[model samples]
Target: MLGVVPSSRAPNPFFWLEDTHTNTMEAIAMTIGHSTIPRMRVPALLKGNMIDVDLASLEGQWGMLCCLPRLEFCDAVFLNQFRRAVQKQGAALLGIQHPAHPFLAAHLPKAKILSIPLLTDSAQRIGRALGLSSETHLNQCQSFIFDPEGVVRNKLTHSFNWHCMTLLLGILKQCQ
Candidate 1:
């Protein structure tokens, strides 16, 4: 499902139909992301202010879009190791957390010191788009890999751990 299309958009598999599609065709296209979609954007910010990261604008760089329940999910040590692992593969990690959590008050200062581009999603806008919610592991952490063209190459929704991180790294390698 991750890499397969249900049907060819055109008689030739390599050619996608353009211009002149009826309303029905357009409706069908809209349902594509129920499994996989073309783009995922990450608006990076820190401490309620924007941090200037435009993940969708990245041409050839891989992006790891991580959604955390609270700031504590990205503790200083974890951020350092996570950043190093991502950077080692020539990729970037972007994180999202609840904007008004108490943990932010205590841990965001340390995150700022680490220069992590942790974003605030008090309204759960991005989280919901990625299918995250309180019912899910009390807002368990999740991550998605966006390739250079902004397609979701892979995704993970689980409790975070070093072993999972290592497995993610391997998956990223395969995507590359």
Candidate 2:
């Protein structure tokens, strides 16, 4: 089991620890008002190239990480919307999907058209790390907002609708 210790820092109320004796990495359930995102690197596809992106290295700016089961036309549209919103706020936006997803190849062109980096988490490591796998829905859509210090400021999950987009935009505005 991973242990979470209270943090004195205002931005992050709690920090997590890994249990060394266990080979399996324990999932740390992130609470909107209580947890800081853990550091990790993930492979990303950008402009038709694969690269590794360090999540913790983005500590100097506001960033949003969106994880979807797969990429579709609707997902692309929402991603573009998020891209515009984040760019307006001078924040970074990233998307993640399982590499083996059935439609991933077909959606490559759409992803290439987008300016943001799209990550590939083949083993679902990122989702497991964020406790997203615990959700009832398999491969649920989720978005996370992290501040400059890498502390998660907000989290949205399940479906992505206009209302959700509006709420996310409002949160981004407030973050700024």
Candidate 3:
């Protein structure tokens, strides 16, 4: 599936979408990050904790919404490179871990899991919201993109590929 539909509450995309065609291509690339995070709503799993990491504090900070396990696998090298990319730019990288794949911990430690215990409804809601209806082929998994202004910039329902990384990295470059 592609990215979620930019909520009506969010602003227009063209205005916020970076001009990735400029000569300074790298200068205007977007950073991969997280936004409109639903986890903020479910506090019971993490409620009233003033002594922990502040996910919201990462707002305005370059983000990368690293969705996990579409094909029951995640490349460690790719993940390392991804983290390295975002880290190099001093941007924040947030991992949107779902309940389906519980094995991400084997390789990732710093990743913050959103913990979506409920799967189907959340998956469909995200699919519709992101206008991923066209990507019927990628229905197997869910992952999307968002701009700094809360805009769902790009959507990916399929597994991570080299092209995906290039695109994600390009976004990260823009964020920097």
Q: Which numbered prediction scores highest in TM-score against the true structure?
A: 2
lDDT of all predictions, in order shown? 0.56, 0.64, 0.40
Error of 3 at 148 (Å): 4.3
Give candidate 3 misplaced runs (Cα > 4 Å): 1-35, 38-53, 70-74, 103-142, 147-152, 174-176
Q: How many backbone clashes does candidate 3 have?
A: 20
* Candidate with the larger lDDT of 2 and 3: 2
How accurate locally is residue 153 in candidate 3, as Cα lDDT from 0 to 100? 52
Model 2 agreement with the true structure over 1-176: per-residue lDDT tens digits: 44445444424422433445674322223347445566788777765566788878888988888776666656677677778867888888888774346325524676665566787677777766665543444535677888888777877663455544555666667876
Clashing pairs for model 1 are none
All candidates: TM-score: 0.62, 0.67, 0.44
- Put down candidate 3 lDDT per residue, 46-155, tens digits, no spaces: 11121233434545555555545442223434555566666677655544334344423333323222222212223434433434333323313344454454455554
Estimate the lDDT of model 1: 0.56
| Candidate 3 similarity to native, TM-score | 0.44
Error of 3 at 28 (Å): 21
Candidate 1 runs further than 4 Å off? 1-43, 46-50, 98-103, 106-108, 134-139
Candidate 2 off by > 4 Å: 1-33, 98-103, 134-140
The most accurate candidate by lDDT is 2
